[model samples]
Target: MPSSIPRSAAVSSVVAAALAAGLLAGAGTASAADVRIHDIQGTTRTSPLVGQQVTGVTGIVTGVRTYGSRGFWIQDPQGDDDSATSEGLFVFTSSVPTVAVGDAVRVNGTVTEYVPGGLNSGNQSLTQLSRPTITVQSSGNPVPAPVTIDEESVPDAYAPEGAPAAGGSINGLTLDPETYALDYYESLEGTNVRIGTSRVVGATDPYSELWVTVKPWENRSERGGALYGSYTAQNTGRLQIQSLTPIAQQPFPTANVGDVLADGAEGPLDFNQFGGYTLTARKLGTVVDGGLEREVTEPQHKNELAVATYNVENLDPSDPQEKFDALAKAVVENLSAPDIVALEEIQDDNGAKNDGTVGAEQTLKKFTEAIVAAGGPSYAWRSVDPENNKDGGEPGGNIRQVFLFNPQRVDFIDRPGGDATTATGVVEGAYGRAELTHSPGRIDPANTAWENSRKPLAGEFVFRGRTVFVVANHFGSKGGDESLTSHHQPPNRSSEAKRLLQAQAVNAFVKDVLAVQKQADVIVLGDINDFEFSATTEALTDGGALYPAVKSLPVDERYSYVYQGNSQVLDQILTSPGVHHFEYDSVHINAEFADQNSDHDPQVLRFRP
Candidate 1:
């Protein structure tokens, strides 16, 4: 939730007027002239023109300053019919006057694109009048929003008789006015109001002043406000909260009924002490869109074939062919070589050769030869050729994790419909609203069925006496997607978002596989750009159908990658239900191998059959 500028018409006018009154702002930010919002979208009034200077726009104001910021929403005459509504979501300056929900006023500002979907049609990008240029022609009466009255945290004194709200102000909390819009809290701080169920942090009593660190229930639960809110600005040390309820939490299977939770306050570590358990606390930080979370550890079986995954850093693509000379040796010698290993982001023959030179064959040959040179070439490798497209990053026309295995262990099975790029078909079942960059698109070169930066390469392998279905993949990436990256002429930030959807596709595919192979053994390992607790992973794992290997490990060594100030476990070893039946020696993260030169670390899971 971002604290942004107020969207009041009065605020918009005053700020823009103040700036132009003194000096001009940057040319890129401010336009010499403002265009009527009605004119900018010459073709369709509903069409969105992102960040265009707009003026002469008027409508019935629909919303006022609410949580996270001070903002106003205006709806066009057709606000009754969503398809015909206009004046998209916009946030304006603070100096502007307060406009009620029904006020009619002339507005001047910028018209920016909302999200790809209309979910945020209410928040069009904006600029505003520095002076009170736009006049309130008629004072619009207050109109109640079409939904339920929000539960707030306001004190009983200001709150409506019986309801418990979540509005409050704690003095020492120190909210930075400059960073987050100040006006957001001015009205609610120290006031008594009902807030939504999702905003509560740590843990608090239904209506009491107590703060509980851990949530009281195992799964999603709700609590009613016992007494009306009373704490207000007058009670400096006490803050009052309103509407309260706990949402769903996926507990780690290893957790006991009363175990206290430490949602990895330090690092991303998960341990499966009792085979399955889950412990959920309040949200720590929101990585991706959802907040951080943890689940019960998933045990690796000792009597089952082992599988592993790794990024291998840049792997010295400078001479991809020659580079394999020592590359294979490093992998086989120091690494606990599993039955299969999926590698991500390597150039065939080094440098940038999407062509046939220095492909998986050469690189994998290096590993087998290295093992042979070491007197133990016990394993063989099988991989798919790059797609017909000739992409450079991966062997299959993209930079991806290729699978290498011992042919003696498992027999390979053919899946005709499995790898045939069912891009859109694979991810359509994921649950959750697709926003801005993560939404589905029409079929085209860019929006084809496959959600992966490249299509997912699936295959079958047999281990021991049983055949195992395997899908070794590298889903997608976050960096280099914004139009600002150099990999292409223009980076597309939406691609970063699409990576999450790609993860959904991976999740959907796994769910589909699980449905078909209820008792079948499956090994799913890959570098999914999202972390373990993200909604993407939640959707991918689909409520514990496939267990994540990291959850079973101790917290100290769980993370496979570190970024900014947070250490994350984005790469992972996910297990089908069958794989969890055995005891595993360990799941290792060879972070040192890939740290300086690359974005990912190598992960190895060892199980002794």
Candidate 2:
């Protein structure tokens, strides 16, 4: 998760952080005898909770929740001790019912350490507690500002009108990124910040609209590299920038607020050197005919247009007729329902969907009918899959991700680099990454053959004059060493590292495409497979032009898939700088859907110009 980071400090020696429990597997700063729960502190320097404890512990209660048959929530409206890291007596369901966010209460819990799950699992800890629960009593209270936005409204209202702002302190707290291994920043819900726009090496313009970095980049140990001072990532790799939309404030019609990193903008406007077929960041600012704030027009009609991507879990046809039927069903019923749809797992070369038997032969035919039936009447599907489905590059997986666009909205642009001008990078590159790593094991399960799969695909399209850059991804499965079996090794980080390389290639490609085209209109949409805050995505956008569509939406609705009780922002839509031109609205997840279908939900967006 992007929230819980393992490393506590970027200092020269990682020895201390490595010894810390949960935070790392190395050394400790304090002697064992002197270690105490109260010693817990925030991770960052600007934090008030870092080296401090609570005083006058009086606050009100807010809300509580008791899940299934086991867990319960204990919340205090005030008096927060951000460093409460242990499974201390400060929280327990037995006495939680008596408390709420509006009532005042005193809290005493050991600031516990965090234990991470993926990536840097060895360097993180949590501010957890387990007992004595919460206490509360009624008291005077200041009505809190509404934290949620109108779920159905456009995000443009959030554009900053005044000056740039910073995410403010919350409950006197901050988390250190390096040594603490604390997973996240203890930000107050809804706090906003204004951030600078960013760009990548090959992409054009402001590069990215909203940028995410704790500070400018500072190179460290050869193995662990952090981007723009955000967190530790790989070094010497490429870097890209992320954009954020600052919330509007008073006086200034649109005051850019703090950075929770959410910005909303619609689609693209085709205008590139390819004679005009690239995504642009300026789409959002364009005024529409009626003067009526556009919910879909400006930028690109995302709100008015629906774009979907699905794994179709198992849509490959074994024979002919069946293949055609399944494809028709997916298009007319599922995929074609959206303005644009990207699909994965369909056989491109294998003669599967042939005859009435349902093979992979006429895969294209199946989709076209659905598009026509779904009303895209003249819709055309794009295919980049191998000609024979025979093992070419990676052999583990097949079924390349393909695109389907509405000719009315999108006009196919030139390849990443072509004649009039070279598309440069994206042809076979990614931005915002330094170096790459590799898995150590040889006879690993993935070595079993099914692990090697078709990589990813990207394309440029012009929608309503805006250029949209779409990158499609299908990551290596969490097979092999992931859920350990002693006989075999765990999924190799090194192998996944190759995916990182591929991701880097994608980033570099985006940057190169922008080199000749200075407009920041771009969107990288696909199955990232990693969460918004994961190492892979971070590496891809450390300093490039891309925005996560989910962030602009409500946190609860940000997830595309659920795993182990937690939701993951897997499939995503990331945009470039032009994102600031319009207002953004996150599409609600369609959850009623079933799974053999897939473990993820498709996200929709509505951009108001």
Candidate 3:
């Protein structure tokens, strides 16, 4: 049966009321054959005896969760010799159980499988026992020794192929813990597990969780993060770490990328909605500063033009002044005040208060004023205000791409008459140079490819004696994509197709500019919301219309975003052939730190025309 309320506190009240009212009368009290933890958690992802009453299940309590889905985990110390079946299982008590660690207990309950985010979320089911009746057989019994999770323990292969009859799902496959990494973790699903002093690859978030890697050498980035280079190399050693201890009892560590979790951690392995295969630590580790410093790109020379792209993450006038100030400092200090910056996610004034208001003049004014306050240049801005509530973002915020340029360093060419629906075209200009038909205009905004997504914003600028064409983009997000730990092997990226089409549209627009002037200088930059090696990037750079500048850096250093312990590329700067010989830097200020102005790290590109 599908779980109606996964991890919800209401589950406790409902289950308790049912038991108190005899709604499930004698469900767990019936005389039945003894069932070991391994038998309940069979070789597959689901329980074999689901919907049946299981009695005389005996084990020692390893951990107790007092909060959400209040339950206690029990493990059979005398486990079966089979390596595929887990020795432990979670007994959902609904309310906090009186049992403590090391207490040997006999449990009687109904076997059930709980999918964290519901059945349609594509997550694997977590086999567990519910409406448990517990009897403390003894106290002070030793808990099962935790299995070490090291590089030698986990397999290099991610998972085996799904059965042809199962529609590419590995859920029905038998566990091969020795052969596949996913199966290896599944084999110890609810059991006690431990990792050595591991490197903190993903920074700790507000959720009081962080990620660490047991295998330091697996796809290691130069900055010590696990680099997700492709779909195939998933870096199996990465695991999520959360504490079973209450936050009121002890505050979670504030860790950044490259930090060390000293002394390691031991915990009950769990599968959840956010990050699958999480280790809810009963014995958590402390953080040791890794001395990771944020990098600053060198300032542009007098003869060179520096351009940058940053996703301010829904910046609006309603946000705190400190946020605006922090972003201004990042732009001025960390980015060295690039001559031109293509900003994404600049929300309309009065953020998220879904009214008819779609103008962002106040938002831009506040930001530019903050830039000057941070001892930076007086930056002028240009943008086409998107139609109210049409672009996908905060309900009514109407986020769009904007151009911020230092008036002293570059001149924005304004050809009037551009609006929300106007599509910009390229035309031959003075001295056979290419110019935009409407500066700060949307590209193919009416096209279905941009249907609820942000359309590419194109603009014209002149620096020194050369003209440059810049297209700022914020493509469709990966909202519906499955996690790397999905039950479907090689998780399907359903959001990729829309991004690929968006990339094609931008590519075609750049091709139009290049066609008008063979040596046209075009810079397409922003959060494409796809990886540098993804098909979206390939489509953007198809036929050599543009080159992704982020690829010029070392593979380890190409990422501008980090998600779920994997450092990856989502924002990029792609240049036309005429703009060759440029220097690119994915400034690592925000994404690697727990305290950040934005989730995306800004990228800058400098080249001499």
Q: Which prediction has the highest lDDT against the true structure?
A: 3
Give per-residue lDDT, candidate 1, residue 201. Answer: 20
Provide the lDDT at 499 for model 3: 93
Count of steric clashes across candidates, in order: 92, 156, 0
How many angstroms is residue 297 displaced in model 2 relative to the true structure, after the best TM-score fit?
A: 16
lDDT of 1 by residue, 128-198 (tens): 22222355677755432322112222121221111122111111122222222111122221111221222
Candidate 3 Cα outliers beyond 4 Å, as residue runs: 1-32
Q: lDDT (CA) for every model shown?
A: 0.39, 0.36, 0.88
Output the TM-score of candidate 3: 0.95
Candidate 2's residue-wise lDDT over 141-201, tens digit each?
A: 4322212111121111211111122221111233322222111112211111122221111
Query: What lDDT score goes with residue 214 in model 1?
Result: 23
Ranking by TM-score: 3, 1, 2
Runs with alpha carbons beyond 4 Å of true place in candidate 2: 1-306, 319-336, 349-361, 374-376, 387-397, 414-451, 481-496, 581-596, 606-609
> What stretches of model 1 exceed 4 Å from their correct place?
1-302, 314-330, 354-359, 375-378, 388-397, 414-452, 480-496, 582-599, 606-609
Question: Candidate 2: worst 10 consecutive residues by lDDT?
Answer: 434-443
RMSD of 2: 18.2
Indicate the worst ten consecutive residues by lDDT in candidate 3: 22-31
Whose lDDT is higher: candidate 2's or candidate 3's? 3
